[model samples]
Target: MPRTEPRVRRLAAGLPAVAAAAVYGWAHWCLAGPASPPTAVAWLGAVLLLVGACVAYGVLVGGSGSVFGGLLLALALLLTVTAADQTASRPATASCVVREVHTRLQGSLGEGAPSQKTVYRLTLDCPGGYPGELKDDRAVAAVGEEVKVAYDPRRRASPAPEAETSPWRAALCAVLLLAASTVIAGRRPGPATRPRPGFTPG
Candidate 1:
């Protein structure tokens, strides 16, 4: 309740927040520009924010009548859960044939250049594997026929064939954040271990 207490608590609570900010912010700058630092920092923000909230909750609003505090805590927790879900979910992959592949005209960014884009509509029925080179199919599929397709469940819109990219660094960030929050929230000072009044020095 004292001004000094609040100030001291703020200082203590600020260390990790400041560290997370610095690390993740640099990560952002590197990922978007350098292209080798890592692409996981974007997800790291949620973890950092959650850990910070847990620390803040313990310090700024540990006593009664802390409705706003609880709300902030819940919001941060939810953000972390969602981030974990996003990071943990695996991409589903299936193969679809090029029943139809063509270059269609497209426009974007308030410009009219008539861009050429490749679009593929798979013919069904082939199932399992896709045509390796289009000329290896035993029975070529017609417009109304079937074809094989490969796609990701998480990224259904984006097709990745033979794509190799790791998201471990990102998920590790979430796990670390979760662990930090748990530790801070559950931490408690141990009982004093000094000699009692009834005890004598050896």
Candidate 2:
């Protein structure tokens, strides 16, 4: 019975890791192929799902309910799948001309509290003969500045020229997160310990 208990515990602990791998594969599959940005409702749904995942994990890990572990795992899987699908969509590229530039002050003005930052907001004339605006924290450009903007019109209403540089970075970030989580999942959590009475030890 004692040996069986340890084996069961290890098996239970490993299930989450297995699920995580499945999630990684599912995300890759969804994102690797042709994709498009999901609707606003879909985005909202994914956020809600992740929130549910947090709740479900809490219920499971806190020993309030055995069923929630499965729920949490499933929710996480679904969330990642949705994210991958949304991220895989192709972006529309257009040459944009900055029509106006506006600056805003940000951050604290107190001494030694970092300098006040300038945020640049630009109104632009984009492709398809529409007016749009983009904001940048570091870019300093005058009115009538010409720049190329890459944007997913469906996902974002306004396209930032600077943002159109890389879509592969998102995939790369997901891969890195998966790798880090895998490393973390492989380790067995340490057993709980009761602290010894301290002798004023720092």
Candidate 3:
């Protein structure tokens, strides 16, 4: 009976992570489908429900482990939103003429080191005024040059040439995060031991 108890506890602790991953996978699949994605209200409702669930679980569970679980759930929410954004848009190509070209040096400090890189922003004029602008690290087009731009027809937003999303990356990340969250939750610290009364130092 004692042995079975630990197994049950572990499963219960890990269930939330598994559920989160499944939810994210479903969202990604829906976003990638031909049908329209969920409306903003639906997304907001889901977010609210998830947040409420986490809060309720933490309050009811009443353990340090719940803290970690809540954090993981929050992270899952953010990842789901990002995956939706990446998959909701259908890729389309348009030919445009560069109306203006601007260049700037973007710098960042990382790992105690500073680095600088050039970024090129191009204003484009397409037949339908689609993908009116683009930015990239490489100067792929010049002013007055004709170029093919990839964009989302629905949003009319142009993502950088190298910023394309991979279909499997989000799934892989969700799976990995789920595994880590499960392990952390399942292996949560056990109750601390107190020394027996009248026990002297050895």
Best by TM-score: 3
Q: How well is each residue in 14-52 modelled by candidate 3, as lDDT tens digits?
A: 666655655555555545545645567446655765676
Report the poorest 10 consecutive residues by lDDT, candidate 3. Answer: 187-196
Backbone collision count in every prediction?
Answer: 17, 0, 0
Residues 1-202, candidate 1: write the lDDT tens digits. 2334545444434434453444444443433333433335544654566555555555543443123333334443443343333333234544444444333333322222113443333333235443322221123344544343334342212222323223454445544544453344333211122235797756
Would you list the C-alpha lDDT of every candidate in the order shown? 0.39, 0.50, 0.60
Q: Which candidate is the best by lDDT?
A: 3
TM per candidate: 0.25, 0.45, 0.53
**Pairs clashing within candidate 3:** none
lDDT by residue for model 2 (51-134), tens:
554443333233322233434445345535544544544467777888888889887533322357788888888877643776
By lDDT, the better pick of 1 and 2 is 2
Q: How much is 196 displaced in model 1, in angstroms?
A: 22
Rank all candidate structures by their TM-score, best first, as comma-separated numbers. Answer: 3, 2, 1
Model 1, C-alpha of 45: deviation from truth (Å): 7.1
Candidate 2 stretches greater than 4 Å from native: 1-38, 56-92, 100-121, 127-131, 135-142, 152-165, 185-202
